[model samples]
Target: MIARRKVLLGGAGLLALGTGSCAGRRMWLDREPKLPLGIDAQGRALWSNWSGLEHAYPASRAAPASEAELAMLLPKAQAPIRPVGAGHSFTALVPTQGTLLSLDRLEGVVSHQVITATVRAGTKLSALGPALAAAGQEMVCLPDINKQTLAGALSTGTHGTGKGITAIHGTVTALRLVLPDGSIAECSRDERPELFHAARVGLGSFGVLSEVTLQNRPLSRVKKVVRLVDTDWVLGQWPALASQHRNAEFLVLPFTGKSALITHDVTDEPVRPRGPDTDSQTLMDLKRLRDLFEFTPGLRRRAAQMAMKNLPEEVAVDEGWKLLSNERPDRFKEMEYHLPIEHQVEVLREVIARIERDAHGVFFPIEARIIAPDDAWLSPFYQRESGSVAVHAWYKEDHQWMFKLIEPLFREAGGRPHWGKLHSLCASDLAALYPMFKEANAVRRSVDPAGRMVNPFVAKIFG
Candidate 1:
């Protein structure tokens, strides 16, 4: 955690004292956000996303235990049938006035071979790690958060960081999908190739995924290292850093002029297991700093720099899976876009400068990552190496600034928004960005002609 003692040192102590007067107001802002009623007037129960940014009271909820059960539910249960996983998505992809189907009961590893594993779509990445480890195998990559189910992660094109690594969907060799009209279609590069290409990152609109086959690697240990460095230095050195490490990513501390550079690589060193996570506490500390110095950028930057100045780097050696993903207890709304690799550094520079200049109430660190290209038709990283930039706001605060100030930059750089994150793009805008958009939509129509799987948000996206 950012050292609180160091933050209170010297002249910064006065600013901390001054904040006491506004305690009542700040407390109100810090309180849990007002929630929607548990039961809506229609008598439907509430279902909300992890960040509480999106919610709905589906007319019915169904958890299917097997492919047969899911196939039976899809055709006749309701129109606009939507499948939900861990509700990790910030967008309204899962909300529906009709049936809300869940795949939680359909979890676990189905089978495995030397370098591949077939898994139930509902298996959480958390459970998948150990299950795969038992077979001496592991996923080629994993996203930053592990709570999301296999289906959710793949559908949204969720990814991890590395120069050569692709997103989770890129590792998929085949999939079994339960279509809207009670038919099952098993697809891969050779069998039903069009469907496979279109639905790999289909955003749940193609159909509910039942099973997935992943090309995995032998389970191995990796060393993780994290250090704080000047933001400018990181910006200049990012390309080399990304190439040097097996997995590399960084968090830019807004207003602080510092960045946390995290890297991981295969190692034979003795296990030095990661300690309890201090990231959440450190995040809240950043929030406190924001509250205290919303108007005084200099002091906020100085105090943060002081606290972070001499802090020791954090290191751990563990199985790749355990160290690759993290626990994110603090809820926040996010907007992320994947851009052409060459424009990443220039875009990041603008993002940081813009946040520091105008988005004063922001305290969340900006995340930067790299993903190699994939053949998944709807994937943000499709056909080109990409670098991703994500911005966040506390769940209780307004995130409109991201759309207003940051999204334009992303769009102008020929970026594509992460399928499940916040974005304002419609069908036309997306068509221009994705070369295969029209063909993918045509494939979607062929499978679900009646549009039984389309929700309002999906409609806007697939028009």
Candidate 2:
């Protein structure tokens, strides 16, 4: 229920008292974590993900400027040739000891034809928006974070929220991949269809995507609305809300008995550009509340409820591309799963109850969204409409509770883990979740017979 302005004003007083003698120990326990070595003993530089949970010191790094250069380097580079984007993923997908392949130099809009644009795999979603807008086109869907490269987004099945909108890979009509053997392969529904299906959500195991053709739509304006509401009411009305809006999602504030409902719809209204970000400060405010009242659930709920009451709704009119994705500056570890749409509400109820009952140290909001199904063999949403639930922990806090308390619920409900997020499932578990898992792994093996792209994590996933 806490709005940006109100929380800023109220937090100033609470924060001052929070640092006093009574809460001094809590502040010390929440300080920044000790950093890893900047450079290892073997002279390899440290490469870490955004959350700082995953890192590696590869023996070599390559930034090839052109497809020709990338293809030429692939066959002979060090083993476990891993491609890295912006390092936004929390999982171990990007960490490798042999070679860190960067496609940063091979980025831009390659070509356009009305509603379609061929983009370089290294093009970040942030840059791709304006580039596509210049041609009067935009992607059909975009993930919540725009820092990831096109290849990274597609490979990991990144998605946005909507009733019928699929993940980013669903819009990919065709793609060019540079195989481990240095051979270039072009695939689509009509050409090499098997490879197309297997590699769309490839997790960077089959090969590195060089270029992708996206099925897009005309650039248009949209209205975005954010309102605070009772968590139970929102949960009951979610199906209707999702169907009514162009896009819809919600954030659950644990111990607060409230949630933020966000929706977007196509609009023709005059532009009222979005305001500066207040989400980061609001998150920190929640953390402050947790630190002060962690031992008293009743007091925590009352404080948050009192602060959030009767706040004004926030609205903005802008291009869909600008409004959909967000800038997340604070770092955290996350675990997310996509489950059958019918099971979402029930599972979410359990998640919230479990967290509120046991995880008093939790302060980050739980996120929920809906995604349409796609045919990509490895995609979590394959052949079934899915509603996703994500739980987070501040980077410096312990995340073992997610695996111990939440993962079992997801597994029991037949949920599939997000490829880029945290989960404990292995190849056998995955094989049961995805109907095409065996075939996808076979295609991966055929393309990279020597396992040149396989890291320890990838091996565990494909075994």
Candidate 3:
């Protein structure tokens, strides 16, 4: 029996099929169920991924593991079949009406070579990090948040603030994708290359991403240094930093006149070190308090400026994974765009001007990053060397105005929006941005002809 009744938060008792302690059960007798057919697991006003500002309550959610298990459940996939990982996305890309695919059971190292591993689709990045470091390796790069699932992060091309490297997908040499028909495939640069391109950043339109074969290198120690710099001077020095550092970027505090410059690089070969994060709570609290202040309207910006001006200088060194990831306690709405790498400073100048002139009501820091182009069809940096700029606001604030102010600025500069980050582009805009947009859709059609893997957003963008 896969069904068991448990008391929910309120007086209500909800029955979660296929996920109780007895998930180990085989076939159960078909029988009428008392609980409503459509509901989420744990049922706490759930949304897909952590792009907290975008979605609220999904119609339903599902957590499945194993190829045969996911195949058995395809017939019941949600209308949008949006797969979610740790809710890390900033967009409604995983918005769903029927089912939400959770890959929690499909976790841990499935198979491994000395350097590489074949990972399950539903694995969380936090789970992946410690495991690899124990084996004397670490993920090449990671976004600020590490809670996202591997499949979901790569699906939307989540990135870090690296200089020459693309996002996590850049290191993927192979993929094990599940077609809508439940057939599993393993694709790589040398074999089934076309499928590899299409699936690398598939946006969950092709099928469930069952597993990924990643290209990993030997893990080595790294040094992370964070310094305070004037925004003007940082921009002035962009050229030199761009050339010298493997990972270099700056975090700008709006109207604060200060920025946090960060650089991470490899050191002479040594095992990475780990220790307590003395500043962990302080950092988390700082982010959380900023979001709290953002709700008070006119007071938020003033407070943000004061807070930034008073911040003390900080610098640290730690394991590559430990220092690269942050414990994100604040939740906000966000939109990020990839523009030409050379225009990074100029675009930022214009954006800053708009914020100052139009009284743009955003308090979160503006993040600038660089990415070398890749062959992934849906990749934001496809065929273009690019610099990405991300903007955010507290979730409680009115975001439509924020989106309106930034969308045109991005378009005028030939910007491409991050698939997982917030943006307001339709199919036509995306079609113009990538030549392979059509080809990617073609591959999806071939793999999921009936559109079983699609949701409304996926349909609207690619149909």
For candidate 2, the C-alpha RMSD (Å) to the true structure equals 1.6
Q: For residues 181-285, could you state the per-residue lDDT of candidate 3 as single tens digits?
A: 777777988888888998899887777888887767677667766666778888889768866876788877565455678787777645444334433343333
lDDT of each: 0.90, 0.91, 0.70
The TM-score of candidate 3 is 0.82
Expressed as tens digits, the lDDT of each residue in 323-411 for candidate 2 is: 88888888899999999999999999999999999999999999999999999999999999999999999999999999999999999
Q: Write the residue-wise lDDT of candidate 1 on 178-273 in tens digits.
A: 999888999999999999999999899889999999999999999999888899999999999999998999999899899888999999999999
Residue 208 alpha-carbon offset, candidate 1, angstroms = 1.0
Off by over 4 Å in 3: 1-52, 56-60, 75-78, 268-313
Q: After superposition, how far is residue 151 of candidate 3 from its true place, in Å?
A: 0.4
Best by TM-score: 2
lDDT of the structure predicted as candidate 1: 0.90
- Candidates 1 and 3, the one with greater TM-score: 1
Name the runs in model 1 displaced over 4 angstroms: 1-18, 22-25
